[model samples]
Target chain A: MVTYPGLPGPIICDYLSREASRGRYGPGVEFQIGKIEMVANTGTYLDSPFHRYAGGKDLSALPLDSLANLDTVVIRIGGGSVRAIPRAAFQDVPVQGRAVLVHTGWDAHWRTERYLSGNPFLTADAAEYLVSQDVRLVGIDSVNIDDIDDPARPVHSTLLGADVPIVEHMCRLNLLPDRDVRFFAVPAKVAGFGTWPVRAFGVVST
Target chain B: MVTYPGLPGPIICDYLSREASRGRYGPGVEFQIGKIEMVANTGTYLDSPFHRYAGGKDLSALPLDSLANLDTVVIRIGGGSVRAIPRAAFQDVPVQGRAVLVHTGWDAHWRTERYLSGNPFLTADAAEYLVSQDVRLVGIDSVNIDDIDDPARPVHSTLLGADVPIVEHMCRLNLLPDRDVRFFAVPAKVAGFGTWPVRAFGVVST
Candidate 1:
């Protein structure tokens, strides 16, 4: 039950005051850790099928195997003139049963206004292609996996509906190699609570 | 930026609606993939110094290296008995520069009311002892790392003030060998947000 020592984003502060407060539960001093708030969509997080489909599994129902222990491939799409990511971007990559990381270099714009505009996103065809590959997960070093301006949001619907967990708001993808890195991005195990924030990370071979 | 697959939990129904509305710019729809509204203390979360100390490093101030790629060790506390987790519970365990995980059997009670009952926790002296060891992190498989019933909350104060991370409400610790498990439990990268929820996990030798 130990955690890494580090700083948290704004969402956590909101959570500590809202959900983690021990105001009720017991004596004013006895903090039983209150009911957590904050949408599952905050910060570096994972999106499950429940995030899209009406009948999809929630965070607590998701299996652990899907969240841990899988081979990973990072596609370094840094320094690109392209605005929209095309289907061909992942054509040559081996994505089956593996975690696919799209390094759009947009993480540098995190917490900034630019990170939201014209950021890199997977084309709908790419989403369908990834589903076909049986890829375990899809992550991006950008704001959202889908284009924010698009009303349809087909990319998110397609991937999440297929039971593929989405990891967004990720930085430091540049620190990982193209292959052999095992990716992990697991959410909390709250019953009936879908789409909360997560502390996603990867493990490179020693 | 790929992710692992997961089973939908009980709260998937509400999760879908909550996540989809956030959009991408403010908060994406697929971030926290689960369905329950958990406290920040639920499911292997980090406790920063701010959780106890009035003027300690919040989640955002801690270093990334401190939470990732840590050298870890495990101290076995059988059956989660309070007497089992004594000041001497960590004796002879190399503490300096190591993440220590105390294996208590309470994880088996996850999702049940018993998981939050009069569970085992470290005595204040035990907390001071670990601090003396200069351990990097401390974790346990129980409700709270310290007895919430206590007014002072010394265990939390001692470790968090020293910048050691504490992971609480963890499960499946029995799956890990006493040693050789690389533990990782990172929080959101939120500045001034100290107590966000996390998906704490470990990598076992394949």
Candidate 2:
């Protein structure tokens, strides 16, 4: 659902035949192979420490505890008056060792021009607070965690520099409850790479 | 770890600066954006039902019960003499409502020329047995689940056609015990797509 204004959309091309065709491989075997060409930041993606620091851990080195089956807390910011999320927003929530997901309701505008303009973002103080709280991961249902117009990207610097992974361009946060949920956002264990797209989701206990 | 003899490898490119560089964005902002391009079958991947059947469920429609946090069992086939796995292999193992992972020790040759030649595969009877057992998912540590020379792809046809997902080209099964493990192999929820790469893993209860 991501539509970065200037970035290339995901490209899916067929390599093998889907229908029965006369080919060198044979006719009865209708295998469909697909080639995907897209930016790692194309869709809902996770950013490892290497995404910001050259010497930091990449996606492959990320520990499973930090990416899988984590306690989660969802914060609703869509109905709030402020766009710049502050430390006060998380003051009452237990964030330590949890995936703190900020539901901004911006994903409703995904794939539209409005999604690219003036989306909600975390303030530097909020990022610094989360880092100090030892949060395992942070996710937002918005285009970027930091303001796109801000050149410094203080949020990315503070969080990623502290080895906390970030998940952006997420959707369906509303489908999850406020607490007692397990979150997962595991990325491909690709070596020498910083950021990669992920299948991010929250597992609600039935 | 997947080397599709003639297919292109993953491409990782920089979209932003890693260090302080004099660019249009700014010098102080040290961000590294990455662009990835590869075939969906580039590495360890999951196959949805649509991969084999046009009218089947795609990646987006796959239920989480079939992909995440299911009880798992690993079967070691490396010590066996036959490359074609038989139904007798699972006679003593409990496979219903579980992820049946076959460990062939072939991943030792990953990224090598020998990894692609004459790999082990499941026989048609084994596939039928798994389907009848109502296994949640199947994973293999070899190049493919079906013999590459077989044009009909009976294993894939039998499994995927029955809505049984398959994970291929996996590694590190040796790190997991034979049982008491939870397996996950989730693909991106892309609509209309049949298959995609995944970050497959097994979770052990400590």
Best by lDDT: 2
Clash number for candidate 1: 45
Model 2 per-residue lDDT tens digits across residues A1-206: 44565677887777665763236344555666666777667788899998778888999899988998989999999573457999998989999878899999998888888889788999999999999899999999888899878777889889989889999999988899999898999988888788777888877888
Model 2 spans with C-alpha error above 4 angstroms: A19-27, A78-80, B17-27, B78-80
lDDT of prediction 2: 0.84
**Predicted model with the maximum TM-score:** 2
* Residue B13 error, candidate 1, Å: 9.4
True contacts kept of 1: 0.39
Q: What is the TM-score of each candidate's chain B when compared with the real chain B?
A: 0.78, 0.92
Candidate 2 residue-wise lDDT, B1-206, digit = tens = 34666667788777555643336354566656677777667789899988777788888899988999989999988663457889998868999878899998888878998788687899989999999999989999888898866767889989998899999899988998999998889888877778888888887888
Worst 10 residues of 2 chain B by lDDT: B19-28
The true-versus-predicted C-alpha distance at residue B44 of model 1, in Å, is 3.8
Q: What DockQ does each candidate score versus the true complex, computed on alpha carbons?
A: 0.27, 0.64
Candidate 1 CAPRI grade: acceptable
For candidate 1 chain B, the 10 contiguous residues with the lowest summed lDDT are: B1-10
